[model samples]
Target: MGQSEATVGRWSEATIWLHWLGALLILSALMVGWSAEHLAARDDQPLLFEIHFSIGLLALAVMLARIACRFFQARPDRSQVPPLARFAASTVHLLLYLATFGVLLSGLINFLFLGPVRVFGFVTVPQLFDPEADEWLRALSWYAHVYGWWALTALVLLHAAAAFFHHFVRRDRTLRDFLPGRR
Candidate 1:
């Protein structure tokens, strides 16, 4: 059955955990990235960049796991939601995923072309592209990463607003479905 037609009541525990974890990781990555870009002093920037890059990589992994879980696990049915609301939710979710992957991929390309990235001084993320010839690619990737982050941030806010609407205004189980022990 389609998401809007199914009658399932709650999301699986794994899905809920993944959703919350991914949210935390993404938020952390965004904060660090913003700091690296706008707040950190030039001397302190490299450390912040490394932290941001590491967090993004971790978020990418979690997102991939979440996608796999979505296919394997049951999701809360949207049958209680209006068709238009369901469509809007799906669109927002799809856009969020696209923006997330865009940011990760572009960041990876930029890092690869710029130089090797050291993650928390433990593991070194090797350079995948030569900087000399791939400067243009790096620049393109930088722009994509920046723009994708903005899009992701906007989408996240919209998503949160929708969730709040469902919880407070609609007075439905929509938000509760993903909350801990809500079933």
Candidate 2:
């Protein structure tokens, strides 16, 4: 199927699997981060931070590959949606991608400068930037990461809502567009 028609066609199995896997990983990272923040106040913040940071790195790697695949694949055109709806959908997706990367980068930077980074008990990532580059940057990055989380959460909710609306309300192929071969 061609690009536009592909949207109405059954989604690739690869796409469906990767989409769900990425969703799980991203959600796990968010949950761990939120838990870490709450638990930090009571006990060892270091341990919680380590778990959160590690998960963030994993989520980052997964998202990078996911984004690459998305671009490589022919996505559905938003022109069919209402003008305002299309704009919102595009904006939400853009924000989700940006925030995913931002959170990953910021956390990695923090680990490199302020601490060490251990990824899934596998490899050790070296720090790219010197800690003394700018004190303000670290603070700014931390804030950005925090805000990015909130933004991602909102976008995810909206995305899910829209997909459901198409499935139940519009009675269209919107949900099917992202589902695996004919159910």
Candidate 3:
């Protein structure tokens, strides 16, 4: 009954929606962050920065809600997966959460120290620290934010690859667990 019960349940609707929403937000944030860094012209940079920052903040909120949902929701049982694979999957998921949170937090901290950012010309996000006085902190946060993005990108790739492996090679419901429908 234990094994049967574990295998029978599907992810909750809330979990599925959160999973897809978080993925979309994170991917969008990564692309916007990259564009702001390398593609935007000097004059257009502020707009791009505003979009990127806003998206990061949104991602942070989604991630926090996702974490909370994980605790309250009934996660689909993983007894179907091999122990080693289960461990690996759990590790990847944990790292994904950590990397995302790290990137968002560092970005917010950097912006707070260096900003009075005007978002899309509509609103100004006030600074937490004076840019001139907290230059050192700003630099540290900038480094963390940049490196955290890289780490998050790597983790995302790995996570996607693992899902594909489970779907194509293992032929399992692991990928389906987070996907909408397919109950």
Give the number of the best model, judged by TM-score. Answer: 1
Cα RMSD of all models vs. native, in order, equals 2.7, 3.6, 3.9
Q: Give the lDDT ranking, best first.
A: 1, 3, 2
Tens-digit lDDT string for candidate 1 (1-183): 223333356767877888899899999999998998899999999999999888888888988888877776666666766899789889999998899889988987888775666986788777778877877897899899999989999999999999999899989777877787775
Task: Name the weakest run of 10 consecutive residues (lDDT summed) in model 2.
Answer: 1-10
Model 1 residue pairs with clashes:
none
Query: Which whole-number lDDT from 0 to 100 does residue 130 have in model 3?
Result: 82
lDDT of 3 at 68: 76
Could you estimate the TM-score for every candidate? 0.91, 0.78, 0.89
Q: What are the Cα lDDT values of the candidates?
A: 0.84, 0.72, 0.80
Indicate the residue-level lDDT of 40 in model 3.
84
- Whole-model lDDT, candidate 3? 0.80
Two-way TM-score contest, 1 vs 2, winner: 1
Q: Taking the tens digit of each residue's C-alpha lDDT, what string does model 3 give over 1-183?
A: 122232337777776788889889889988988998898898987788888878877878888888877776666766766899789888998898888888888888888874678764577877778878878888888898889989988998898898899899989777776678666
Query: Which 10 consecutive residues of model 3 have the lowest summed lDDT?
Result: 1-10
